[model samples]
Target: MLKMMTYFQGFSGHQSVPVTVDFPRSPPKLPSTSEAESETSMSEASSEDLVPPLEAGAALYREEEKAAKKKEKKKSKGLASVFSVFTKGKKKKGQPSSAEPEGAAGSRQGLDGPLPTVEELKAALERGRLEAARPLLALERELAAAAAGGASAEELVRRQSKVEALYELLRDQVLGVLRRPLEAAPERLRQALAVVAEQEREDRQAAAAAGPGTSALATTRPRRWLQLWRCGVAEAAEERMGGRPAEGAEVPESVFLHMGRTMKEDLEAVVERLKPLFPAEFGVVAAYAESYHQHFAAHVAATAQFELCERDTYMLLVWVQNLYPNDILNSPKLAGELQGVGLGSLLPPKQIRLLEATFLSNEAANVKELMTRALELEAQRWAQDMPPQRLDGHCHSELAIDIIQIISQAQVKAESITLDLGSQIRQVLLVELLAFLRSYQHDFNEFLERGKKLRSYRANVIANINNCLSFRTSMEQNWQVPQDTLSLLLGPLAELKSHGFSTLLQSLCEDLKPLFKRFSHTRWAVPMETLEKIIATVGVRLPEFSELQDCFREELVEAVHLHLVKEYIIQLSKRRLVLKTAEQQQQLAGHILANADAIQHFCTEHGSHATWLQPALPTLAEIIRLQDPSAIKIEVATYATSYPDFSKGHLSAILAIKGNLSNSDVKSIRSILDVSTGVQEPSRPLFSLIKVG
Candidate 1:
């Protein structure tokens, strides 16, 4: 782990100290970062540390019970005979106590013997004879009460000096044991806690005996020992943080990871080994948990002030926001241990949000950089005129595969950290991807327009179309993307795909140009071979389209179908025609129907799924063929009903093609189409592309 400035020090045990944590204002720059090897070793140690052996815990508990019994027995037999009257019974009025036994009056000074040494007091506390230390506690209280009663200050100081020094030494020992429970004996902790409890009781009694307005000394003795106890627990937590990750060291692991493991193990020990030693009012478990939590949060904030790599940042975020609560604090071993405890986040909400935003921003930037590089590489390949790679006889580009890998890998990695995070990361990637797609579309369109003379032009165009189609399909399947983002992504891809299809179709249409020119009302006045030629020219190019993906192949075929029908309609509508008789109208209508059948058969045989478009041309030819004015009007209205995009210009062109319809009759039929309502628009409209005069 990398270490930084030391923090969370010098906490006071008697009062709560607020831990101040400052976060870095800016996010760390994105770099490929590696995890430290120490984390593995720490984790290995933690697994064994989390649960102490049942036999060991039970034995320790038994030993504590035995020591406590011994202490009680010794107090009853040894100290009780000497100090029992002082604590329990009322002193006799004007009479020596009988418990002092029948002896020489000169021997009655045993209680007045030399005050106990610090070593003796410590040894007694160690042996759990807390009663042996009670005399000193009484003396300290007596000196305070005397001072309050206006005793000479010098006399009070002379009397309290040695006793106060020994008691202070005892207080330090108790706090020392608390400061390092992992290394201290369970007996030591029990005795220390008992000493505090005894002092509290003695102080309360002294206060009662002195009464109000006489001696505030008992209440005002500062209770400094309790304050030192709190400071000790906080120091214990700080020590467990593994101390400043060896200054100048490269953080091979997440600092928080190591810190979390140490905290968890120690807290487990506190619950299992130390909780029973303290009074319930002391909240031993909660005290340690809060200290550990506060220190952990402060350390993390300090670490955040440094530049953390992506892996470390994510690890840090996960531990604070997810792992600490779920794995460490509420672990099965410590279940129900912290309920109702007002535990807070390891990092405040604001810091967590900033961390998350930084991660997302870095990821988005990385995606953009990768996408840009991919395009640049592809452009280099294009400049060098490398032929497109083919997959199963279809032109192929690695652009889609590479770009998809980038986005998907980021998503999976983000999800590995957290689910809610995955969605956020994906959104930023999508935003970058949207911009990348636009660039792709522009590049592809430019290639199609100007790279026609290049050897790989046709194949590159097809491959790019395949890429767009692939991108669109992936977005549709990705559940993490919001609907609006998905819609935004699909726009450029759809345009690119349509443009590619048209580019391919225009090449085919170019070959069919001569055949379309041969189409005319005059030419149809005789039997013609134009329809056969137009179908043959397109049928040859239809096989080239099979190289597309199944979805794209079908779409391209449908586009081809629509284009053919629209072009055929244009030829008919603009052709020189004057069929003034019913016989001539029937002849022209028959030719139109034959052309419709040819185009429809060519499209279907080529795997077009646009069956909706097959009826478009045939229905128009039927209107041209009908002679009954009412029948003609019905057919025109039917056409409009089926294709809402069927406009007035289309209807006028059809009637003109009939040639026998008078101006008044044309106007009357047009009204039928105009009045038609409730027409459902076709999903792929064809007539909307046709322009007629």
Candidate 2:
């Protein structure tokens, strides 16, 4: 029962059953600003990193408001109320005339085909100067009108052909500019490419900082978001464009890449660049993430396929997601367009969802797999083994560290992904490792069985104890994790090691159980060598087991003393008559006194255990020296009465050793004891219950 009690309480310094862990809600993972200075090793993120391009949206809203204000002021300030109606017609009349001059210029060039050369269109789009393409579009439309009107001449047909060829040549030129080397691409294109490229570099750094822990991406939710940074390109563009977009007759604000910043940069340069070929890139990046998500959601974690995917395919997907966040372009989104929403009204706030949901659905499944694997292996190695095996430290360490690595790596991504599964993984690993160590009880059983050769058993138990201790020490010394998670995961094994040690002490206690009986009639004082040998059991496993020495030593002396007293009483009974004469009595008593002196010397020389013998031995000596029958009877009765459980044979032995009592005297002594003990039956002896020698 003591051993069993120790077993349950050993791990925690108190009792607690293992629990099935629930995934904890991961708090919003903010990029650790301290990581730049600490082991996390991530790039430092100051508050300004997430600040949107300040001039992007706010300035545009104000400008549109200012323009509306200017228009209303002009209408009101134009004339007196009486003439306002007449001037309103004049204003309408003035609008068409404003276009007449530009139309005249278009008509004048109609004969010459006003066609834009391939060089002219490419250079304009690459520089994001879309206004330059308008005259060319105007000429193409005029040519189409002339052809449809059935008016064709030699030069008309020739110039029309040139305008017709402009379409493909213009498109190919734009695509070529879009596909230019990224560094040489316009600034806005470079900004998008630079941000993505930097994110990739940071991802690699995070992976390495995760150290030896298992990649926690396996347990990650299928959805993950990573925040992006701006490096002055978009803001500089907004500052130059005055936060206004140009479309068609002006610069076409291709909705190609819209920064989700407060001042959303329409990425006019990206517009001109990607406008020709954005859809193809979109289909390629989105297609893979979308297709993989279906298979990921369909499979359960228990399947081996899911395990394989979690370790391999999932990591690859993560790499892809890193390269292209969400697999969806972060250009712009359709919000509310039921009626008239003027320009900036459709501008959406930067989205706050995970950068991608492509990875979220399977996080729980991966979490489940880790725990399921741990519990399954725990059940296999402990509950089902035919003969218990020593805990394979290397194997279990790898398993524990694998779990740790998974959590650590996941944590690196969690700054963006919001993984709730990390803490649970660490907890399950702790429980598994603890369970593995606790299974050492079988080896302990073998250690006990080997106790006949006390030295060897002591050596074996000590070695096993130190092995558990060393394993725990190594774990504490090397287990790497974030401090908060580290606090929760480590120390479980230390408790198990402490428990194994306590059980070892208890094993020593058990081995000493029947040993006291060996000290019988002639074996009076326990031999010093024998007592020393028993005391040494604890010392062999010492320093680590140092605190238990007092307890073990005390129990040892009590066991030895008990056997000595029991055997001494019987030895007294075997004595030859002590009093044919006084000389004979003295000789017999002296021998017993000498043995008692040896016992006292053994106790004083060795340890604290024999302090109990100091007063007990002298009183026993006085009782043994008595030679008168009446005195012997008084002493025996007093001693037996004091120690009520002492047998009648014990008193008889004392009387026989003194040789001072005849049969009549013995009978008389018995009658006195019989009356004292309230003996009611005549045939029954006074100490009939005792196993008297």
How much does each candidate deviate from the true structure in C-alpha RMSD?
A: 13.2, 23.5
Q: Candidate 1 regions off by >4 Å?
A: 1-131, 134-159, 184-188, 204-224, 242-253, 304-327, 330-335, 350-363, 391-393, 408-430, 479-485, 525-530, 676-685
lDDT of 1 by residue, 378-473 (tens): 977776778888898778999998898888877876775578998788667777888998998888777777777888777787888888766777
Q: Write the per-residue lDDT of candidate 2 for residues 332-355, one digit (tens) a residue.
A: 321121012222211112211221
Ten-residue region with minimum lDDT total, candidate 1: 26-35
Candidate 2 residue runs with Cα over 4 Å from true position = 1-135, 144-159, 181-314, 317-419, 427-431, 447-457, 470-693
| Candidate 1, RMSD to the unseen true structure | 13.2
**What's the lDDT for residue 347 in model 1?**
79
TM-score of 1: 0.74
Considering every candidate listed, which one attains the maximal TM-score? 1
TM-score of each: 0.74, 0.31
